[model samples]
Target: MNDSADYCDDFYNYVCGGFVNSTLIPDDKNSVNIFITLNDKVTKQLNTIISRPSQPDEPEIFKLAKSLYKICMDTNAIEEQGVKPLFDYVEQLGGWPVLKKDNEWDESLFNWKENIAQILENKFWVTGFFGFYQTIDIKNNTRRVIGLSDYNAGLARKNLIKGLEDKSVLNYFNYMVNMSVALGAEQEHAEEELKEALEFEIKLTNLTRPDEDYRDQTLAYNPMTLGDLAKRYPYFEWKKYFNYELSPSNISVDNDEIIIVSNPDYFDKLDELIDSTPKKTQANLLIWKEIRSLSGFLNKNIREVNGNYAKIRTGIIKGTPRWMKCTNTVSSTFSIATNALYVREYFKKESKDNVAVMIKNIHNQFIKLLNSTSWLDEETRINAIKKAEKINQFVAYPDELLNNSIINDYHKAFENFEMIGDSYLESSSNLDFFGNKIGWSELREKNVPNMWDSFATRSSTANAFYSSSENSIMLPAGILQGEFFNNELPKYMNYGAIGGVVGHEIMHAFDDQGKQYDADGNVFDWWSNSTNEQYKKKAQCIIDQYGNYTVKEINMNINGINTQGENIADNGGIKAVYLAYNDWSSNNELEKKLPGFNFNSRQMFWVAYANTWCSKSRLESQKLRLIYDNHSPSEFRVNGPLSNIEEFSTDFGCPIGSKMNPEKKCTIW
Candidate 1:
């Protein structure tokens, strides 16, 4: 029998010598190679797990155990040494919950104003380090200019204060700052702890050197099981322990009673509009429109603001700068560009039919899932499904906004570039003064078409997101590739990975935050009081569950208040994906089995789903994410959901009363 310490040493050796050797390559110019290597290792491990049989051997389990063991070792090492100071400081300041409860604690009311002082000090530090402003050459149609850094700083500061006016937003900022400080401190501590743990573990074990392959030996020794891995590593064990009591219940499987409104024609018309236009012309039109839009805004405000510059500057410095970019073209242009690129590429693909099929299926699945929710009242469920069905699926991209004539027209309209810049600034001031009187129609008419080119270049990103305000889910071409989606791979893999991602995005419409918006993307109380209360109760359960997990020696504090929306989205996404898969399965689709893998197509689906999220983060990045990001760590995302999912447990034959299977599970939509 192997001693626990010996096991630890061997695991350490595998991580440093075998795993790192296999994944990481040293290069002088690129310091981030270690992170990349770790990411690759995680991806490879997930793939292996996915390919494993339903009843994996001790070897398979041990491999997973070893990987997780190393992860815990690395994480704990950082938490104890690097992040402890910040954690302690934040704890002393009052944990998030406590600080949040003190709503009436105003800086002016306090004797010393500790909270306000800390915030001001941190703001100064940030301004000093990052430098605050940028200047743009309004006349030359170029970004080059002086005073831009100050300008940008002023704008950033203004935005920050505006955000702070809302108590929730202010708290979020405070949380981010506190968390950032904590993460930075914790990273140093964790690194030192990891080095020491590695050294100690290495001294105890006999293993092959870093240069050699360990596949033969890995095959010889049966890898640790999940149970064994959790027991041996307290860090990993703690997550499972907490999850046992906190994991939310599975969503109901019956999705038949829901009303699904189908709009298979939305994308078709959008495609026809784009296909009729020439690509180069469309691209040129987009650029021309963007340039003109910027010029138009700058033309109006440059002079008016010049007169009030000192007063505006004072207000800005005092944390009360007015919103000056109500008529700004940058954000709108960016949205247009991103949307256009998405639309163009989508139409170009041979799988237009496939895209349509996916959208229709997503719509139908959401309707069914909403109707099946036992907790939601009939009226709420009906409205929720209506919202889901009403959601407009914009595929590929929007139609070209600029024609040659329109571009030329806008170009001629901006004869004096400097005046145009001043006019642009004036327009912003006017919008700020008037408030929503500028109207969406007038703004749309002035909008340009340059976003397509920008988006086409940035097409390789690996994620997709939903916008509650827009009631849209963007499926970029970048994430449409890889393990997530490939035309050649088996349907099960595609559905499990990419399809799962799509379903997840669709479900966001009904997640805690998204549900706040109605079908038309308006914020309104669409649910009954009883239903709303039930929803809150269910959401709170998820918050409590995730809040209990810790990262880097500090409790994650889950900010259930803040992250409840995202957690709900995640839970719903998984369920939506599963239901979408079932819908596909019912069509008598044939399952293809991979060679050397014991799992059938159904089992492989879950494995593929889990594999998509196998990733690692730097301690700093991880800490930042815990504070600012809505999603949980990737590990928790997989394990947390899998534990709640009976299907996953059943597929793996997870033992009853195992850490993964608790007696009570909290269920929500």
Candidate 2:
């Protein structure tokens, strides 16, 4: 935890270890990372808007966001209402057997088929045994396509199959059974029923492919028609199910609707599993998933139950603060509206302009990296440079957030939901209806299928991303503040922090999965076979490098394959930003350092880079992230890249073969 330790040996500690030791994690927070810290700051800013009394001058969407947040904050109202609203919902789905009177479970009302139809009609996105969502077709980004993929079984597939053998898995099982008991079933009956439900989820997980399989877009993209889906997996009533989902909306479909079934084999296996599983068990499983999905919106008891259960799996000792949780829900439900208001206050045009210049600097340096990389042949290098140059940037926020006409259109999309009752559950249901239909009308005009759209995450998010489909890097306003960037700060600091972020996202376009897509965002590999092969060999070095770094508290090694894309991006991004800083510094020729620090500007650049990633995580949070997150821990993020960079070794004057100056280094741009 020494702050003055030689950075060349362990830079993450030299920069962050003391900070981690000094900071106290709030009772409500499981862990605090760079992203979490910044998000909390933004949430506080949003609280000002949410907690304020309604004003006559406020924008229409701003009013909507405030109303939603209030309902989320009204815990007394949520608790007073009790389980009646939830019971009413379950009754509409034909009632849960767990809630039925002893030996009097009615077979007539609990029709699984009718229940599913009603669930679909209500626009409740319940991912039971199957999941359905709309996205731009991977093969054709211009058009939207419906994807009925595998249901997640409420946990990661690996943990789900491992079952009770894993401590976390056992905790989740106890939670499922506890939920059943809370709803008024006999304790023994609840346990027995939920055990069968767990078995059903296990079988579902076994049939599904792991996350690694989806990394390759070529393998992931499986385009087929409705007719083909039926032909391939005859067990599912494809026509009836999809028609039920689409009938309530503007989307129309029949046997000819072009659907993208990502995993045909999983569906085939699922068909067999579904046919063999009992109707009662299927009903129990589906209802349990729905209950799980909606429980948090119910009374305090239900919310606490779900939160406690999630804590076991996530290592989160407590639930997020009620205000923060509500803000997240409201923001996601009405992102465009929330973000439109978000843009006016904390985010402005000036910050966007600064980010634009930084983006250009990073992009130019990235082009050089692409052109100069030795691993890629001439043909591959030229295509890589084209992809890099074509990478468009959406800085701070999208332009539409500032346009009244578009914001009004989006606001009008949910106008009907304005009259939803004061209760949280009531508003949630209305949002389900309003949220589904929000952009559906436009699909008919554009002939676009359901696609990914989120202005809130895009507008105020504390992280940056590169969308392979859009071939663009999005830098949200939330990440624009903090140690990441400041216009008044020295150029060295900005380049090390936000400059690296822009570069990281840009480099994602050439990462393992991203390289599968071309400059046009189409799923086409432009690399020669040899270049592709060589790229893997170099990437393996990173996989090995990161895989060996253990999360000491949990003693879990990094999942390298799952995180390879991010690892590559980290290395490539730092390289890009460093070189970009050198280019900028040489041209501008500015000389300044922090008033008290002894480090030169060149040394400060790397120090700033490490500081941006400083964080403190609890054991539970660390354990969960090791299994779930794509990026390695913040510690390894600093050490891994620097360990492989010769410039770092030279700057720190580390001898050859030192901990930070390995003789062999891995590099890929």
Candidate 3:
């Protein structure tokens, strides 16, 4: 605590100022926060698991994961190969035009759609020209559908639209040229051709919807058959492309198969861009996307060039350590096995039961708040409470993870996939296809009942998530450690930290985005029209409130529109958890206070909450996050929510008009 600082003026500073001022951001890290600290701990634990030599009786999945890590860590193997693997990959794509002499390249021999379909078939890189994947149909959570949308380019739409004048765009263009030359293209020719390709991407950016348009589910839910898609936008051969793309899974799609096209307007505009652009330039851009995607996996020279671009984007003084990078890669690639290993070795069984109890208490508190909220009409209130009651809470690891049969069945896809001990690039390339095989295998199947396992093998991640499609919240075992929770901690401390996290996820079910989904996770409007209007009116106040606050380091204000969902969750979460704690404490005996603390348990509750967000970040990273991150800066996350809760000011005895106790406060829940 900063004893000299006043709680009323700025509670974040009062609690976290001393720590934030004293801590230095690590050279390799862009920012240091409670979440990052916990993630690093998880990574280190994974390192310990993978670093040990494989036991004779170890599971095949574990052996495979360790092998992947070994290949990544063997820097000598990568350096000696030196761009040959990438050069061979380009040749497999029927050659990049920039790499060819003017007469050596034949335009008639190049078929852009064939190149794209082959890339999609291998699943080496996803975004180029456009993107397609299978996800749960939002309108029908029981089934999955093929989703099509505009290309997620190498650069964001905002940066790409800025043209070469923007430093970020210029850096990207330079990266393309340097990488192409490294792959044996002539420098002057590479630059000239890539410039045209860069312009083509800029045109591509204009075809997509604005970033905010994607927030609403209804705008993106255009369902059509493959036949209809081809008829509507005849420039690309949709049916032929998908038939080849889905061949690996042996699942063929007829023209009548229903597909979800998220950005219908993008396809309408895309036909024009394709007609005006040259096939050669289009080929250059497509192959360049491949080069960009695989650069980090290649030699040190390629990674260093890519690293320079990353330094400009993220503001880190050094790259991540090799072991750390390899550890994370293995964790992602073999998520289920790694998650199983983490739970068996480190997670305590009691934490799950303890956190579940807290979840129930916080859930009941949310129902109470919904019942009392006057802005909601009777029907809206009933529907809101029903949704809250039905929410699926997944605490820690899944029960299925303990079953060896299930783990083995999940990893059976890798049995036939070949991997060389020393050839990291070929191994990585093969893994991409196998990874897509797992994904494409999900097409047209019922949603998995064990939702935690169905997600991107992230049960080992030190983060929590609210999935609106499933109408569920996942509290992975990885996040239930360190400052978040422990079996021995006081209930008040747990409620203030992890308990708040539980409430936050529950609030997401009613936030701007999650509210669109009904209790069954279908995208249906269950609220009364008048109540919906009232909800928006309240939401606007929060938007205006947060938009006014500025980050001094970056001279930028928070994107209130972009971050409103998280802000709503943060504000409502604190209220629910605080009330839940009060109710429990009143029923039980008063908890003992912490040693050396000059405050009661209630005051300590606020302190624990504030300390959870104590962090220091590089200014360059802060600037980028301020523009792109969906949540507010850490300081704002702490101060912004505490200031809105009346109990906080009362506990701290703040003056009514002070910064932490502003007369006009925004509340949505």
**Alpha carbon lDDT of each predicted model:** 0.43, 0.78, 0.85
User: Of models 2 and 3, which has the larger lDDT?
Assistant: 3
The digit string of per-residue lDDT tens for model 1 on 308-350 reads 3322222222211112122112223223322232334333464
Candidate 2 weakest ten by summed lDDT: 447-456
Candidate 1 stretches with Cα past 4 Å from truth are 1-348, 399-461, 552-557
Top lDDT prediction, candidate number: 3
Model 3 ranges with Cα > 4 A deviation:
116-127, 185-188, 449-452
Clashes of each: 51, 2, 0
Error of 1 at 337 (Å): 5.7
Q: What range of 10 consecutive residues in model 3 has the weakest lDDT sum?
A: 117-126
Best-first order by lDDT: 3, 2, 1
**Candidate No. with top TM-score:** 3
What is the lDDT for 111 in model 3?
A: 66
Every model's Cα RMSD, please?
Answer: 25.6, 2.4, 2.0
